[model samples]
Target chain A: MGARRLAEMQVEVTVFATLRKYLPDLPVGGSKYIKVDPGATPADLIQILGLPADEVKIVIRNHVITELDEIVEDGDRIAFAPAIAGG
Target chain B: MTRKIVRINMSNQKATYEDVPKKWAKWGGRGMTSAIVFEEIPPTCHPLGPNNKVVIAPGWVTGTPAAPSSGRTSFGGKSPLTGTIKESNAGGLSGQKIAKLGLAAIILEGTPAKDQWYYLVITKDGVEFKDASDLMGKGMYEIDEILWKDYPKTAVIGIGQAGEMKLSNAGISVNDPENKPGRYAGRGGLGAVLGARGIKAIVIDDAGGPGVDIANKELFEKGRKNLTEAIQEHALTKKDGGLNAYGTDVLMNIVNEAGGLPTRNFSAGQFEGAAKISGEAIAEVVEKRDGKGMTGHGCHPGCIIQCSNIYPDESGEALVSCLEYETAWALGANCGIDNLDIIARMTRECNDLGLDTIEAGNSIAIAMEGGLLEFGDAEGALKLFNEIRNKTPMGRILGQGVEATAKAFGVHRVPTVKGQSMPAYEPRAIKGIGVTYATSTMGADHTSGYTIAPEIAGVSGKLDPLTDEGKADLSLAFQASTAFIDSSGYCLFIAFPILDIQTGFEGMVDTVAGVMGIDLTGDDAIALGKEVLKMERLFNERAGFTKEDDRLPEFMRYEKLPPHDVVWSMTDEELDKVFAWVHED
Candidate 1:
């Protein structure tokens, strides 16, 4: 048998507030699609994108706030933000 | 040295200067204004009648350069909109100039005897009342242009057509750093109060005036350095961070994604076109078209954290200075209009016409709901602004504010508290802010207690926006702290770093202590804040506000906002806990 190949899943990620600095090429509110191996989580994406965990105060998956370690599925939309406040 | 109090009696057309009372020694800004209104004005008096007085005062640190954002001037009176004691702060050259003139407060009292309009030209020598018949019906921009021609160095505070009509949604306009009539003490219908006084404008020229006196210059310098460094180092307030780079509209995407953006007049918590009006998009436009348009602009002369901006049209002509988060949300998402250009125009018109942007936007939304205009119709909204300028009957009804507009149009789902239109945040999505709206003395004012910092943005600490647990306590602390900050004349945005950086908070207290020549700790600052709130609550109590008045509108409690589908879940019992300190005694 040939070496087994793992399935890759693609997820759309958006960053906001100060975290947008990490993806300078992307405009504000613009999302980027990233492909990862099966069973990829928010934490894995954070590592892949090289964002500081402390700076990432919020993470939303499919419009629901999720944890950094929550498993992500294909076509999941994720967003990150730093500590920001305005009325 | 005793600070002077300048009191103008429009009924007699006389101005008097008196030494600051010993009782007002510790009071400044909101504290001073609230104390004066509470002590002098009768609670049962009509807000626009002769009995009500408008008090304008700067904080103790104002004009001293002790802090970068210490130029806020507080305008307080019995609000015609809410019938409650109100204090609204604005950033411009007025506060610093007033402080430099050695004036603690400029109180406008009693109504004019005749229909003639007058303008007060205040200088170090004295104040002169000039006939302002030429400026009677002009917009703020034209008024500023006329005043600046004669008193170019003076900071001008004036009203416009809305104020001339004595509309409840009218606001007092202050000239920005560019001498543009853009900044505003923009809440509680204080402009109507001024308008009722028949005073068109107040020109303050502080040249060769007595500047602010500092008690401990060394300590003040040290504290100021510490705060300046902290602000410069903070991720949010720093040069390239959210505010300086893109202005406050940077909050649009985050607030929208978090499901707390009030859209379509509070019917939904999210707007699909939020991204189009985001601060990022604004920065792109400014960058793509370079001229007079730029970010990192300061509203006042000494503000270090320049969160204001100048937006230009497609042809690179300036449209407005400082299209902030609240205006963007209220005029953009809340109206279901995603176009920034239209929102910018609306903002400019409101400033020029001397109307509060939040109130105008809320009233327009109600009109849309009532079928006067369709939702997302930018052209319709622009036409309504013209109606207001022309003082048509429909415009007059809408100018009365959101509640009046809703009643006139027979719409039930009005988003207001105590007759004042709610700001940008959706109450259902952010429960802590909802509590603030329900309990704030000024009615639906977000700046009174910015719990959005901790609840939605995690500035101080992370609190789940969906939960009600600990929200009452959280809101109380924020309110108390904000009251103190407002008294200090610092921009409320400084709270972002002050909450997280211990040194920053200590530095702020030290600056005040140094200025006053008194020993003050962080705890003492909080106590002063509580005292201000207590005085305001007492005024509201005398005005007949009970626990029943401290509540979100009925619809907010039942109608579930979309995305989260959460209603305003905080109980009235929880809201009563906000002022538990007053009851504890």
Candidate 2:
């Protein structure tokens, strides 16, 4: 049953700023839908997305900033950005 | 050599240079400007009247290679918009040129006896008031071109039609490194004050001028080197940092993702079109149209953190010098307009008209809220810009600022504190910055204390933006530290690396100490900031501002913002605690 659930899971991931370089095919301010294993954490998504941990400053899941250990459900919307601050 | 203070009396039509006062010898930039205005200008004086003087001063590290972003000039006076003491700082060649001329401050005092306009030409030799009657009613871009043609080496600080009309939202434009009238000491209606003085422009030429005098050359160099290394090493300010790579518009996506980007005149916490007008998109466009347009440009020379960019038209000609985060958010998302081209054009119009883009955008938003125009109407926005250019009665009303516009149309959802419009951040989503907007001496200025750094960007430490706990202390600390940084003439952007890195902060303090020939610790820096704030608060108190003035709009208290569903949870009791240290002293 777990394997069947893993095969059915997918998530939407978006990258911004310098982190966009990690997903070369994605345009700036663009996002992509990626298939992931069931109950995949944000850390697993980062690995799947091929983003280095040091380059990723903050991550948001479903509009709230989330830790890497937090579980990502199917169809969860995720966004990540590099270190940036401005008025 | 002692720096001289240049005072130009518009009433007498005379300019004089005097020795710097011993008490103000250590003060520079915002410190000097605020100190002078607080001492001379009457708190209750009409902001655009003869009694209110406009004071301009360069920061202590200005004209030196202390830091890459150390070219900020401060403009301080009584604000017609907020009815409070204000110091609006900008990054441009004006600060560097002024400092190189060995002047501590240039005070514009007394209104002109006549209505004729004149320009002040300042060089190493002296300052002279020249006939500028013919240059009246011209846009800042036209004035910039005319001035540069005549005084190619000088930096032109001038106003536009908005200022000539004495509009409260009027700003003073300064030529950037490229000699384009782009950078503005924009806020507080200071340009209206300058216009009241009948000054068209002040041309500053540093040729053959004595540069800044460094007291401890060896110590200064050490501090400079340390800061340079820290800046280069930091991920956010380095050459490949987010800022240098995409400019300040990089914050658009981050803020939007965090659900803090104010959209549609502060009605929404997020905008669907935010990514379309982001810094990354801006860079992509510039790259696609790579003629005169370029990213990673510095506003002034000697800046290593080149966070400014040039936006070009389809034909590859320069359309705008910089499309910053605040401008993009204010004109783009706040107005419900998503097109970058329209936003860039609006920004150019604001710069040319000598209007503060933030205030102008907020005023336009207020107009939309009042049913004068529909939200997201690009053509209507342009038409309003033309109205301001023509100085129509309605245009004049709108040009007065967000508060005046709200009053004119009876808009209840006006997002302002102390009569000044809030910037891009939605206060409900970001409570710490909300606290700052309410309590800042400068009245809803983000640069006065950018609590967004820690709350959203996680520069120093991460704080949940939705939480109300410990926000007062965070706001106070940022406000105090920012005051110190503003006085130093370094761009507030340096606070990012400084907050995260201890040696960077120490290097900045040491650099100022070396320049002033005094010992300074971090605590002393905070104390200096407190002193500046005390002076400003005293002036505001005398001007009739009370604790009641320190508050977000009434709607923000009741209306819940979307996405976060948070109202401004900070209470009046919490608000009063922001400057508690000042009262304690």
Candidate 3:
């Protein structure tokens, strides 16, 4: 073969608050691992999970609030939160 | 209705009503309380001494049924904890009732000559001093039950055993709509000030009282309609929105994800147990248990946000009401405990003992760091609360707050500013909040300036949470805006929508203008905020606080917190700029 597609990468994903409705199979406050392309971004993953872009206010990768377009690597831990705040 | 000031002299036990001075007519809530404290109390005098006075006031819109979630009361006094001029606001029936009674402010002055406790019954007519010896040495819940039996259909504000013990961590408790010892003016140890005055409680009966006066009915309706619509339309505050769905603790997972959650005595940015105590978890457990527990509860009547909750036990009995985000993080993540049930129990105990949950939880975490117990020890944390209840020497030390506990244990990594413990957000990760914690007049208060909105939640706009650039400006604007919100008698949560929507901000200003019949603009309202800050700064300066006291703890400067691995990088120059206008004034 002239070129072989890069191996699919696994990333741990968790959704919190109202966004939990999209990931119905995920237990409350629990996370699951999903396979994605090597150069996939958080937005790509969100699209795969069927989450609306407008509903998500924050995208966190490896415990840091990041842009939805930020690159997600293999074995990355990602979390999504809605527009929520309290003092 | 003619709004008047009622001065209660504790020395002679007399309550006298004085007409509101022309100079003080425009003030209400924190503005009214701070103005009174600055004028009456000597800065150098002992906070618990007779020279100090306590001022209780309602906001301009408090008693109006048309104003949504505006029934907030402000309590001001010289704090025994920090020796600073303190204004603590709470939500309950007290503000609405007091305002309806036609009182602008209730000033409690002097100290009792004898070592005895008394309660005051305030009606539309006058205040009556009643013997409270029978209710002495009781918890807040017990006090609420006893007081309601004798004074039904009224609002009660009182202190519990913690205040009776004259502990610096004690907070004044106010009854919610259900008469629970939940709502509180829970910071700065104002409860100790009240305890020192020998007053156990004040029962307010608004029945037969004249209601709040609105100078311009058409203007009031216009402003009220605008604000109500904004609050209803905003995604974070509207029905079935973020706050209404999950309460404030909804920020738990998000803060943790932002690497701003202070975990295990500020040593870490994220807690492995964050999920267990997150608001999402609370909502799920409540739904699963299907018990008496429920979310979307209001702390006071006419609150459309309804972000409070009632947590229940395994038996389906209610455990605690309104388990807040700050309380959850302080007692759960900061202390390294993950169990929601244990955190709820500790919250219940704090309410009963009239303790500030933030201070109490920080103290416990400091104790853990000192090796008194292991992190994540739920039983040990509960036992420490028992010590406070028993008034043991150890208990007394812990009840004195985070700084005191740190000193007692020789722990150098204390997370406090101005002798007050920090709330949930980690300063290292969120630089703007760090500036707020360092420079806030009432000590390290998050509500003083909540920059977490732009920094983490993407409300209004997004900013780099880890950077020091332009943070001082961000914090100053928030602090100034927050001062206006606090004085208006609106809950600080209103800041969420007002920041995102311009009309929401205009609507808020218009309401006050409508109430006072004054032409006030948004800029003028912010100027009012700066004016309040100036008074507070002058008071603190007289009380011996310098730019030196406006600083984060030494350890925060050196230690690199995990995840982001950042320290308190903002310099003294940056910190000084926050209140630079105060100094100029």
lDDT of 1 by residue, B1-585 (tens): 678999999888889999999898888899999999999999889999989999999998999965777899999999999999999999988999999999999999977767878999999999899999999989998998899999996899999999999999989999997888878998989999999999999999999889888899888887898788778878788887778887888889888888888998899988999999988888888988887788889999888888999999988888898798888888889899988899999999999999899998989999999999889999889888889888899989988999999999999998888999889888788889898899998899889999888777767877878889998888888888888988888888888888889888888888888888889999998899999999999999999998788999999888988898999888889999898678585
Interface Cα RMSD, each model: 1.7, 0.9, 1.1
TM-score (C-alpha, index-matched) for candidate 1: 0.97
Positional deviation of A80 in candidate 1, in angstroms?
1.6
Which ranking of candidates, highest DockQ first? 2, 3, 1
The parts of candidate 3 lying over 4 Å away from their true place are A1-4
List clashing residue pairs in candidate 2. none
Superior candidate under TM-score, 1 versus 3? 3
The regions of model 2 sitting more than 4 angstroms off are: A1-8
Q: For candidate 2, report its TM-score.
A: 0.98
What C-alpha lDDT do the candidate models reach, one value each?
A: 0.88, 0.89, 0.91
lDDT of 3 by residue, A39-59 (tens): 899999889989988889888
Candidate 3 chain B: worst 10 consecutive residues by lDDT?
B576-585
- lDDT tens digits, residues B284-380, model 2? 8998987888889999988989999999988889999889999998898999988898899999999999999999999999999999999999878
- What tens-digit string does per-residue lDDT give for candidate 3 at B202-225? 999999989889998888888888
